[model samples]
Target: MAVMTSRFADGLAVGTNLVDTAEAAIRQALAGLSGPPDLVCFFICGDDPDDVGRAGQRAMAMVPGAHVIGCSATGVIGAGQGVELQPAVSAWAASLGDTKITTFALETLRADDRFVVVGLPERGSDDQVAILLADPYSFPTDAFIEHSSEALGSLPIIGGLANGLQGRGSVRLFADGEVHEEGAIGVVLGGPVSIGTVVSQGCRPIGPSMVVTRAEDNLLLELAGQPALARLEDIVSALDEDDRELVASGLQIGVAMDEYAERHERGDFLIRGVLGIDPEREAVAIGDVLEVGRTVRFQVRDAETADEDLYELLDAHVERTGRVDGALLFSCNGRGSAMFGSADHDALAVRDTLGPIGVAGFFAAGEVGPVGGHNHVHGFTASILVFSSQAAPAAGA
Candidate 1:
């Protein structure tokens, strides 16, 4: 497959400015290509909601016959900084060899016994992977992940939720040369191509793993027979004032998979945020639903912890894969500048660990990757798909 990537930034003071900038970027990326691309992923960043959609349309018009899928980002990532606020667009086009591209959209994805996987083309092999872009506001992301796995039958799914303006409803998703408001879209690549995935969930576990003695769906009533909130409070109270404050603000919990025999480690647990505390019920509301019997632990997030965990995951993948040709990063919108207090922290890590290959992607509202051997909608995370060159064929027959 041939891959071409380009970014364009213009002083996007108006909608017209955004359209011009995005058109220029798409044109530049496709300048030397012999034919139309099989797939085009466009990532746009801007303050105006209407302008973002217009810019995306302009980009789609430039790349005919390519399946376009993307969304509005918290900030735009490209060859440099300042593109996020300047009405800029970054795009990556792939010309697949001997591979057929199929695109689909699932407007309403609910749990069912035999529901089809959204955003994935119907006619694909078992080896196909579904790359999804979903709207978190309307869809039950957790259930979507679970049921998608069930319906798709081990076909790995990757991508993230389309982010909006703050917590409002201004997000956008692009497909088939148009933008959408509330839905999911994906493309299935079938044929000789092989795709390798890596999810960098930047979090470290703290304390020992404790089993849930009592719980309900989305609420933890007790851990080890103690009230969930009380147990969490005790752990945070023991820390210093600064640590306590950080924990109080961004408190999270880590749930360990029961099938794994080894002790709980950093990546072993799927990290989830603490949604609310039910003082009357003595229960803790977690971002993810919990089963009656499960193993979990209280965890925290900070720059040092996040950086350490990310580096560890990346290093392990590098050692396993040896080397790579290129990489696509779908990072959480909350991570780069919001979590690290600056931009490019995750990108820099990729460059350092993987030796600077062609990298492109957007800052998604909620990241998607495999956690505990299952696909999940993650927060403050980074999911990377690394493309490596296949070994040459053996000597002639």
Candidate 2:
């Protein structure tokens, strides 16, 4: 297990057997606290879906009064490493002296013409931090995020999808010690605590910026008055052998969040995948929305880019906050050994930058975090939430 202690709380993680992992993590976390923790958040993995509830019960039995939230995951993250697609468990507990911690659950339902989300409670009064675990099957995460962006008003919502069943039967989520098979379970934390977040999209800009001269929703008809495919061909001809190969493997579109900036860099772009292309009209269908006049650029991602982006974000976070008490990492399931070609790439990045801090989380089907001031559902991304005890408000550099 790994533990990071601040003024009031401690963060902890452990991985072993199903129930044993939770019990051990809870004991280690509570050992450093002055009293009962105000909140206990956990993510675990087990071959059997029935083990989820038992693991949660084991953890809660150790910490009687703390509000508990947890979910089942494909793999568990903690102890300065990630257990990719393995049986493991990780828990983050906060003592929270006087911080107000409230746990809640929400679900989305089809409302004929639109979807209506139920069980969404009011936001916390102060600048609260939201941690969420959603069911990939039942929840409309994209629509919910767009709605909550307006409702929560910059309140950061960061978490991952439950991968217990990998979108088959009901996956389990935890709220107040109960295991749920549907909906999203979350906890809103406020008062005294400050949180710094870094959602590493793990991509770097490739080509020069261009304006979308014409488009239809997510379909890009033209770029700088040229057919999208023709523009891409031209750009491809200009690249060296390696870059051309990268384009063939993973070419993405980047939409500039702030077009008025004099210069744009890697983080300035909200990167989206190029789903496919229509040669008949030479249009490109991207994973996100597009408009007629928005500025965009091409981007690429591989192991090198992902490493640089994640570490750069982490080192920058440490430079700003100085010290992090605890961290929750929600990494895309596509990451881990698949992208980085090794286990524990994302979790170890945080440990190398922060030096053995408290860290725990899981591999998610889809990750949720802010990209240029708005929360969006992302894939092949690692979104980190770092907790701080500083008097200053939380900021991501």
Candidate 3:
């Protein structure tokens, strides 16, 4: 039996019969598995009242004993294709051999006006990766991530903030045979199975790296001993018309992830949004924390810049490690038609460069991936997990 079962394709048996759709997805996922799968995940998208939940339940029944987890999405990503605002399901099944995959569900409730979270699993020393999905409307995902950071240590969490309907949200998570309309769900992959991550923040570094000469918490007071806003104006004054327009549309700050590098590059910085500027105080507030001594740069992102950045990162991954078994993509919903001008732009890039393998995921409200070896919530980013497969010596005849 193969160590893992890997297959993914878009458009799973479309019809009024939800059972057929569910069964078809199972067949696609298990096509080449010589033995029973160890884990199964299905991400579904549709407007039908119960299509997402029914498909999830029926899909699990088809693969009895397989640990199944998934959720409904505004968009479904499969293979090298992305189906947006449509009725589609993407299923993935795997056999990790000696690897251990544990599933858990979490919900938040108020106690004495304080929000309390339930369902975080204990992490083992050998655990290396986590696949997380949560309802964006109800779950305090950012808080959960912050808490997990200290507890989980360096374990990389890669997934998305569940995207859904408005007005209480159409959030749904599937664990075992049950569908949850609230909270979060995840699978922790322990033992030797590791997740190699590629986080594309979709921005190009503008201007030079400047050290933060003065700052207080998240408020950036000064860069290179100058007012933070003043430094930004200087950078903008030097840009050409198009790039200046890009900055005008929306600008961001890039906190250097690794300061030891001789030349800071695109991937060196963790891009953050500028929340607000205090002109009177000559300071600016960023989404992420800032410190007095940290090096930083101004960054700009547009369709062309984002496209180039994602391609470069994916190409670098392919060159670094030639072997890939499968991948789980957690992309910001803003990236699909909103940023790329079409669907499947990111998926196609991955498949075109690393294809003939399996891939499945959903368009997320916020993508989770690693930057500088730490997991962080990101916007307009594509957080990918590339499953690396090692070669075993051929058996002697």
For each candidate, give its TM-score against the true structure. Answer: 0.84, 0.94, 0.90
Give each model's clash number.
1, 0, 0
Superposed Cα deviation of residue 158, candidate 1 (Å)? 1.2
Ranking by lDDT: 2, 3, 1
Candidate 3, residues 343-388, lDDT tens digits: the string is: 8798888777766667778888898887887777889998887776
Winning model by lDDT: 2
In terms of lDDT, the poorest run of 10 residues in model 1 is 5-14
Clashing pairs in 3: none
lDDT computed for candidate 2: 0.79
What is the per-residue lDDT of model 1 for residues 1-397, given as tens digits with 9 covering 90 to 100? 1133222111111123778777765664555245566677777777777888888888888777777787777665544322333456766666556666667776764566643335544545534566787777765666778777556766667888776554456778888786887777777656666556777667656556778888888899989888987887777778888777777678888888644556777777888898989999989999887876688988878888889877887787666656665556788877877788766787678767866454557788788777655777788888876655563211100
User: In model 2, which runs have C-alpha deviations exceeding 4 angstroms?
Assistant: 4-17, 32-34, 110-112
**Model 3 misses residue 118 by how many Å?**
2.5
Residue 214 alpha-carbon offset, candidate 3, angstroms: 2.7
Every candidate's CA RMSD: 5.3, 2.1, 4.6
TM-score of 2: 0.94
lDDT of candidate model 1 versus the reference: 0.68
Kindly list the per-residue Cα lDDT of model 2 for residues 323-379, writing each as its tens digit: 777778899988998888876899889889877666778899999888887788888
- For model 1 the local lDDT of residue 286 reads 93
